[model samples]
Target: MAEWRDPQWEYFAIQSLRGKSFGDEWPTIPEFFQYTVERFPDNSAFTTFAGEQRESISYRELAQYVEALARSLQNLGLTAGDRVAVSGKNSPYWGIVYLAVLCAGCVVVPLDARQNGEFHKHLAEFTEAKAVFMDGDLLAKLEEAETEQPAYRKYLIQSRKDFADATGAKWETMWQMIESRKGDTTGALSSLAQIRSDDMAALLTTSGTTGNEKLAMLSHANFTSNLIQCVYPGLQEILSTDRLYLLLPMHHCYPMTAVFLEGISHGSELIFPRGLAVQQILQDLKDGKVTVFMGVPMLFNKIIQGVLNKVKAQPAAKQLMFRLMMGISGVSDRMGKAIGSKLFSGVLKAMGFDHIRILICGAGVLMPEVGEKYRRLGLNFIQGYGLTEAAPIVTLNPAGTSEVRSVGRLLPMITGRLESSPELSAPVVSVRGHEVGELCIDGPNKMSGYYKNPQATAEAFTEDGFLRTGDMGYFDRNGYFYITGRSKNVIVTAGGKNIYPEEIEELFQLCSWFEQVMVRGYREDGTEKTELVVYPKLSEDCVARIAADRDAFLSGDTVKDPAKQEEIIGVQLHREILADVQRISRKLPDYQRIGRVRVILLSLEMTTTQKIKRFLAESRFAQHNDGLLTESQDF
Candidate 1:
């Protein structure tokens, strides 16, 4: 391994001691993980649940697996700096392959499982991946999409019974590597390929290629610096315990670095559920005794909402006690006394959060109301803000120094500057004179550049050398950052006031009736008006009543004509949903009030990170109707 030091010595010199040592600053990703292994060789390292099988591996065992895989790849005529692709659901095997590829001095390409096969193919060719490791489903998809045989070597995550490709061929299995090296592994586990700190560690695709590849290229130094920055008073505060809940997909940068690799850095075990199936997640929490849980906005929104709904269904006396405890807990939280653990201890245990210490939500916007509920219920709730280009982490809510509304302060040794986005006309929206500009950051953790796309790379950074994050935000008197909305997502009113649809959308998010809501401005009769597109989620009571009415109609006990009854039910549900939205949305100012509404039956499409893809949704609505808002009725 190369002994790399910070090129910008002057900048690193003033940083706090928190980031001093990480087995040396120039450590490779494999070396860093190995360092943790040396610290806790006998500790439980990884655990995963898949269907009927449950597996656990120790740090020492995991190191041997990585070495075995690297040796296998070496025997196959591959050397350092080769590219390998791994695709599968979140499992311990996926993680093992990911680390093993790096251990062999190969750059890993992690593709999103939700993406299409053609996109995946394009990523493989763009990165020139020499080999691919995939599960049965992905292998089938790859086979169907290709007319000619692919040149890359193939490996399987798990063996498929009697499975054959187009040529009736069987691929090698990942488990074989472990079996071959079970014993009599002397020279195999001893030496590793020489890796430099500046070598490319991974290539992460941001979007579909348009003939110009725009994969975010991160270096070994980039990964190491971020790991050190995070370990030193970074995530180490939350991940100090032994076990962490790996909830999100490993392909996404947030989970890959912040949760997965962060856990390895601290010798904390990871729990990967069978799949993201609802019941599986609950069961995994119970079985794994997860200590740190990291997720996005949707995860916490549903979990917290589920617990609250259960509380409401309790008997009157029990409900009264729960409410009283919650009230007292809220008061105690304000006074810096964490009493929710004792007050709502039963609620926590019931939800399988008996061992949960910290709950970190990132990758999407988290509604403040949901965050407050968790905090009041005695969970340490945190919100983070970042983009893929920054190796995906720029700012996270500090454990003890967190603020309710802010996204916490910038990471230590990371510099954030607010650059004027006069084009968006986001007029310093604060009265206290804080500049509201596109949040641009400068840090060693930032990516080198977009892969082979100089035009895109040039546009990503400013002349002054900060990566322009294209996110419109402002900073408080303290160094904490606040994101208002994306630059392209902002809507300007005729009155020349900047209106962030996210702000208006957040107000409606407080109500569960609207499953998905988006606020956008449309021109109608030469006037720009605010419009809301909604997908309704029926209340439990309303759904039950509707089902009961349908059953009575079917039995011919309530209505003479079933079709008319169905029509009436649909109309009633629409009215109920509209009324609920109107009641909740009235809290917004007159200017921010929605002037029109469009109700779609289907839910809006979201990104892998669970963010609603706004432009695509608008296009979908436009394709189906002449106007996005069919009914220009305002409430």
Candidate 2:
């Protein structure tokens, strides 16, 4: 009950807003932006960075563009409630289009531009979108396919290029449309006034990483409320002075609400990297002085891993010194002193993180070690948990008093309960829980329902109206939630033990030899057992160590034939990996321990967010030969 109280920072954050009008929440996202634009008209709202060059639009300037574009859409025969699809890479222009559609009182359907034509086509037809604003290249792909396009009444290009010649149609560029209608008279504002807070604002498709796609319907209140929820819980300190980095795909809800919407709502500068390249992001981070960085676990792990790898390559004395410094920083952390920034100033500057105020990871499981390493390095790092159905933000670790082991404490005003029952519609085998089970949530930020799929909408919630999160997790005594794994991904062993692959996969993440890892249950001798499929990323040191073990195994009579070298290496690799697996498995419960191990050279198939597609991974490698270095089970 103590955890259910209003967030401590809410009063302070709300009072700071102009006239303290946004105490609970704004009626709509448009109204919130309107307030911000009026409050910080000249403040930089959106910025795009490309190496040393950048472009920006102030809040006032962006509002003008949004108003013009909204009028342009209305003039082009679009009306209120019309579905408009917007697909593009992350950019200020993309944000403008998204806001403009909402301004026109139309539902914004944010489709994944990285998806293939068929995928785009399916979403368009599924939503029955009346118009589409697309990037030139993706539009070209649809035309190149020679298939009938989705029934779109108007096409607006996101790129600066006029693709009339290429497409044999006079498609208007987004900028051209906005500029041409800047002063044009329209009734768009009137329609926007009529748009209700409960109206469906955006139709977002759930990432089918688990191989299932459903369109989620989120409302204006959902988006607006969630942004408030994101802040008051911990990030109320973020101000107009902060620069929020947008690295993850903006089409996804995680970055959309966390970075894009959060930045603009706070009147902060929203910085978009020119490209997703690590170097490009680093350049932008340093040059732009971004204060907030929100990214997925994969990207964060890669970044932290790169840093640790460099430290590991250092001389023994230097490596030990670095650890000592980190330990010192950790002590300072517990003492409520932030000396990591001072302690690791050189390291921070080198990694372009010297100016970064907050580092947040979400969208996938993050190893606790990774989270601990970041804090010890003197960074304000936090992890959060959410799904699209919850307007994508259910919880955020309170910045100053974070519980790194848990995903985060529930956002202010969100109520959650754990239910232990496989009979529920959750796609899990054993919904185990005396303490852990499906996490069900209820809050104003929760989505209205799945788009047009009544059955799924019905199944997605409980009789009491709490949305079934389909994630297996439990709350700590302090209300911080720790996710075990997805309900759908639970592996039930023959001994009636449940194995959460993500939990085991995190242990493997601590090992430098693995690029990626996925655990699943396999049948052996008419009984279910744990098996591991891994993509190895052996370091030079790892190779040398394994080679030494191999030579010792053969009593210094190593394979002489060149052809046999590959065979010898393969056997040695399997033995080394298995030994490591056993070493790590000892920490896990006996039933959850891996019995068989398989090594694959080729990378596993992954979603754009870098989550390994579990179903696809299992089936794709089922027949591959050399990729599989199977070891006999002894567990």
Candidate 3:
């Protein structure tokens, strides 16, 4: 099959060992899992914090546990076509339970643990789940939901010590059930009989980049195709002995597919972090000897800032030497990987990333400058583009062939198109250089539909069946995709020109003072105007210096001088920030230019993947309109 296909997909049955097949006869997820278990039975499959102790489970052991749990669920009178929901943070037990549910031929629903109680209840009821396996802390919400929506027959609690009291009478500890079964694999083969390749395997909720969220009904074939078509080709160079560090929540499709599932399929050791604290992550990186590090842009930005801060604290001569070394590394990277990898080993090892061979970035747009910096530093950092709807991977930059600015080439067996709208009559998309448009995808990995919501499912696709990805992007001549922004987020000026806030924000990423930036339009006299809100992360030493100077002045000491006042320091900092904003604003158009800028002292609320909740901040700006800069009402 060609990489790109027509709008009306031609489906064919795929061949497989299990006698089950999808379009063109492809093997399903269970078949793939069977293959992996047989291939790497003795390898360590997963590791995570169990209570205060770190627990490691081998592939063979994990397979046995999954089978036993499947048997237990079957014995409880749960049928093959039932819905089971799993809500929690990433853990080895979560992985085992997820696979076990699928092995029993039930559709798995992985909910975002961070969602509000109302949204969580709505989704559980929407999916019509028969059973739920949740982190014990969230049991109360489910119990409340059962009162209004009584479909669920059981609730299984994850045994975290703090949440023991939250469990209900219907609850059973996941690990306890598996332990009692004692590796019984009696009905494992028979359970596989009930599963079909095209049946819904998992229901992953969309990130809700727009207003509301919907569940994508992905099949065993959908996920398995993604594993083979997207993940395998990108990881061709990565070895089975490599260790992949899993930091983000595993329920997220990016980490679930790229890090967790890929590691299991490739026989790599997956090391789960105890938490997201930088200090803890650093220790885990050193202790686990993690060879593959994957994360979102925000986490990488923090790590880079931390490294630079440490470098700045060193003496003048050391700083000069480091800069010279970085220059050499940049030159080597421009030359190619063979030269760069060998030349930058010393610097990379000093930064504690020596063992890391690949760094996969996803979730949100990774700044090009950051990608370039890591490339020069000898870590093969590459961007991956996908969503939960496509089993989360459609494209990944191949090592050695990657470009800094682009998000890499499309993966095998995937087809993409761009349109002005979701309608079939919508114009064919084009771009000036790397300009973007609404990105659409069609492939074997594409989802079946939004689960149980026919209206939403119908709205999510074009008449010709292309998945309408609310994301806007354009592809270069080299087939490298560059995401500009979301269609809903584009700021339109009075002149009718569209501007992406992310483009403007990317320009400010290199600025040292600004910690976070969000650009939006404010309404004035029924007209829209652009504004920028910035959260400045001041240097700790600078804050201390200002505090000391203020304290000394207030003490009425004769030694205190007005020239060294805290107010003076504040004025100087403000001037520097104004200059930086002006420099960036020059690149933007007149209407799109920032009119109001505010420097916030506190960090903004962010998602688990580190994307700022724009709607929350937008509402805050409206509530405190007095703090913002505004033009005259006449304008």
- Top lDDT model: 2
Q: Which stretches of candidate 3 lie above 4 Å from their native place?
A: 2-24, 49-54, 144-150, 153-170, 186-190, 232-238, 337-347, 421-435, 525-527, 538-579, 589-591, 600-605, 620-627, 630-635
Local accuracy of candidate 1 as per-residue lDDT tens digits, 21-78: 2323456687667767877778888887656576788888888777777777776777
Ordered list by TM-score, greatest first: 2, 1, 3
lDDT of 3 by residue, 1-635 (tens): 76433222212212433353232355556555666677788888887654456667787887888887777777777777788888887777788788888888888888888876666677768888887788766776667655464677555545434234553545677766666675567534324547777888888877754435678888887876776665433333445788889889876788887787767766788898878888678767766778989898878887887878888999999889877877887876777634556666765666668788888888888789888778777778888888888888877888755487777777777778877843211233334745456888898888988876899889778899988777788888778888877777777665556767877787777677787887877666676667777766667875565456544422324223333332433556655666788887877657668876655444456666777778777665565432223232121
Q: Pick the candidate with the highest TM-score.
A: 2
User: TM-scores for all candidates?
Assistant: 0.87, 0.88, 0.85
lDDT, model 1:
0.72
Per-model clash counts, in order, read 0, 0, 8
lDDT winner, 2 or 3 = 2
Q: What is the lDDT of residue 493 in candidate 1?
A: 75
Residue-wise C-alpha lDDT for candidate 2, range 31-146, written one tens digit per residue: 67777787798999988755467778898888888889888888888877889988888878889999889888899999888888677667777888888788777777655653
Give the RMSD in angstroms, all C-alphas superposed, for model 3: 6.6
Deviation from native of the Cα of residue 572 in model 3, angstroms: 6.3
